[model samples]
Target: MHSKTYILISFHTAELGNPDIVFLISIVLAFTFIMFLTCEILLQGSLRDHSEPNDEYVIPHGDWFEIVSSPHYLAEIVIYAGLVVASGGTDLTIWLLFGFVVSNLVLAAAETHRWYLQKFESYPKKRLAIIPFAY
Candidate 1:
């Protein structure tokens, strides 16, 4: 949906003659990619670390897990935000797409966090659902 929204907006706004807008898009894309990669790596590493044979589930630690229960979901939100920025930040469809993505991810993350708390006795109490410091 994010890619489709970006492509649709780009095609519709093909006459974007502002170099600053292009630069902003480029920077946003780069930052989004980096943030996504970092979150994914952290999530993957956490999963791998807990993949050992065990009778009980282990709460993932390290990286953003120290702050949020679902870093991957946060990364997903960041990706959609980047798409919105790349779509020139004024397209109603892109904004709606971003809002949808954010809402769904937040809901999923909140549920995951609740499950974690219920399933594990050592779950971090300070962690938010998805966003750091604020849910």
Candidate 2:
């Protein structure tokens, strides 16, 4: 996703040299880059990845399951949004926008549903999937 954003930025600015659009694209790219970096360090993987097979689920243990499970989806949206804003009113921009939204929605919904199934028997019965109460 990050590579794709970089590709779009390079191609568009090289071919068209639109300063204003390039500036906006640069802003989005910077923000998304920061987000990815932060997520990389802060995001804890699944409990099984961090712990022994015989270990029990507990306070900090559950936290290891997912700091934020849908990060890749989030990155995809940011990349496509950056592309759309960079391309302005082009057909590619519009199609990318639609595809991003639809794909994110589908993936987020499926992940949330899968999360519920996996965590149903866990201690944190109150923990809602995905977007807190909104999910």
> Per-candidate RMSD vs. true structure?
5.9, 6.9
lDDT of 2 at 126: 49
**Where is model 2 more than 4 Å wrong at Cα?**
1-20, 42-69, 93-101, 114-119, 123-133
Name every residue pair that clashes in candidate 1.
none
Task: Give lDDT per model, in order.
Answer: 0.86, 0.56
| Model 2 TM-score relative to the real fold | 0.49
* TM-score top scorer: 1
* Candidate 1 local Cα displacement, residue 130, angstroms: 1.1
| Model 1 per-residue lDDT at 39 | 78
* TM-score of every candidate relative to the true structure: 0.82, 0.49
Tens-place lDDT per residue, model 1, 73-135, is: 889889999999877788999999899999998999999999998988878899999989888
As for candidate 2, its clashing pairs are none
